[model samples]
Target: MVFWVPILSYAAVILLTAVAVLRAPAPRPPHLAANALLRYLNLFPVGLMGLWGALGHIVFPARSAAAIGWATSPFQTEVGAANLGIGLAGVVAAFYPNWGFRAGVAVVTAGFLGGAAITHVVEIAETGNLAAGNAGPILYTDVLTPLLLLILLALTYRSARGPAA
Candidate 1:
């Protein structure tokens, strides 16, 4: 039950990361190829994360909520919808990858993940939720992935700076 969430989350992250790494754009030329890699790395995994967070809860509201030890309620539905929206934003940003779109997605995702991490910590402190879905290894991702996203965003800016900066 609880274990499923961690397994699913890790699997999703790994699968998406692999896609980002392996299916990197090969649209000719060396430097453009680098930008392609950067774009894919920035977009796909985070989009997948958004999707993973979104799909189950929105569609299977009860089971999704129960998996995280929450009541099957409207709150879960709302959260699921939010996730779906964020995920769709990620998808749009992935395709666009302009400064405005990419930066917006990155910032929104970071804020969301930060909030999630805080909730996990608060849950641990207030109610002792140690479920794999809640306080398991996946919890670290709620903290780490956002930071990595910011770094990836920075890489975009760095690459934009033409390597001297």
Candidate 2:
């Protein structure tokens, strides 16, 4: 149950984001400009998180330790970057209701999902272990983060499309 809770939560977030995005409006020049600026700034943190994750995997060589250590490493940095990107995109979308915001969300979400998937697969192949009996950070970073991002994207989209605020 504990293991599944995060998974379910992530799924819910994704569903919500998808609905929101679909309801959003077309891109506007002003919104696009703002989102573009935010996107550029957000990339820095996201890159850091990714780097941390990669480094953790490389240095620790232990799934659980690698996952936990990632918090202080490049992985966390990347996650922070992505969080900023998504968050800014959400805010911009709410204000602008445009395609640029939606696209930003999509791009960042994809990065999270893509990286997590790749890492999980590689870990499984090399270590022949999946979460190593659920005492590892791998599940949180590799599975939970992507799942939540997907949900957040969906919600952001929905909010963008909903009645303008």
Candidate 3:
């Protein structure tokens, strides 16, 4: 369940956003799909997922550690704090929707998740830790979510710029 939360959250958000965007009225403004997707991604996967992670790591440290195939430690609290910060940033980005603010949030989120992906990889290589949290959907999401956000960011930027000269 620990591993599934991130995966399911991401999937649910993406899928629902796609459906919503598709069903919206026609004569849509520029970048409607991209903008909607970016908003939903920030609000749900990045925002809520990070908060959930914080909750697990801080409020349920032992379970969080075991899921990751690690011993519980003081570091979990620190990690949880980081998660809270990033998660709040994501939520704010969703509401604000300014290009720079959203971009900054996306970049910061990418760094955090990218670092996590590396650590997961290292744990797998050096320690052979294949626990669900270490080797499951979370690992993939950590890598892909950032990539998707960046792609959407770029697309939105181009859309905002209008067609090339």
Candidate 4:
């Protein structure tokens, strides 16, 4: 049940936004709906991860520490703080119509996730930390989510620019 919550949260956000896109002004360009959807979707992971970390650190330190085989300490709090800051920055980027803002935040967030995936790979290789919590869905999502965001960004940029550009 706990496991399903995160997955459901993501799906809910996406599904709700899809509904909004579909119901948007019909006269707009075909890509407009998709672009708007992607713009909102870009913030999902950051917000989810941010709140997850912060809550884990503050209220559920035991479970959080167990997940990564770490002790409950101030480090978890620091991690929580960083996650919230990064996530909030993503929220700020969500408002801009300019690709520059979107791209900047997307790249940084993706880079963070990319780095996390690498760390997980290293932990698996070096320490054989096969704990489901350590090298499970999240590790892969770290890579896949960012890639999806990048693809969305590319599609949105190209859509905005047109083929002639």
The top-ranked prediction according to lDDT is: 3
**CA lDDT, every model vs. true structure:** 0.67, 0.46, 0.88, 0.69
**What is the lDDT, from 0 to 100, of the residue 21 in candidate 2?**
48
Please report, as a residue range, the 10-residue window in candidate 3 with the lowest summed lDDT: 156-165
Tens-digit per-residue lDDT, 1-165, candidate 3: 876787778777778778978788997766888888898888877898889889989999999999999999999999999899888988898888898898999899999999999999999999999999998988988998799899999989976566781
Q: For model 3, state the Cα shift of residue 2 in Å.
A: 1.3
User: Candidate 1 vs. truth: CA RMSD?
Assistant: 4.2
lDDT of 4 by residue, 46-137 (tens): 65565665677667877877776556787777767766776776666556567777777778878877987898799899999866556776
Model 3 off-target regions past 4 Å?
A: 161-165
Per-residue lDDT over 89-114 for candidate 1, one digit per residue giving the tens place of the 0 to 100 score: 87777678575677777788789878
Cα displacement (Å) at residue 15, model 2: 8.9
Candidate 3 versus truth, CA RMSD in Å, comes to: 1.9
- Model 4 error, position 13 (Å): 3.8
RMSD of each: 4.2, 10.2, 1.9, 3.0
Per-residue lDDT value at 160 in model 2: 49
Better candidate by lDDT, 1 or 4: 4
For model 2, how does the per-residue alpha-carbon lDDT over 43-147 read when each residue is reduced to its tens digit? 322333444434434554355243432223445445455545555554454455354554665576567656766766666677664553233443454554445
Model 4 gets an lDDT of 0.69
| TM-score of candidate 1 on Cα atoms, chains taken together | 0.73
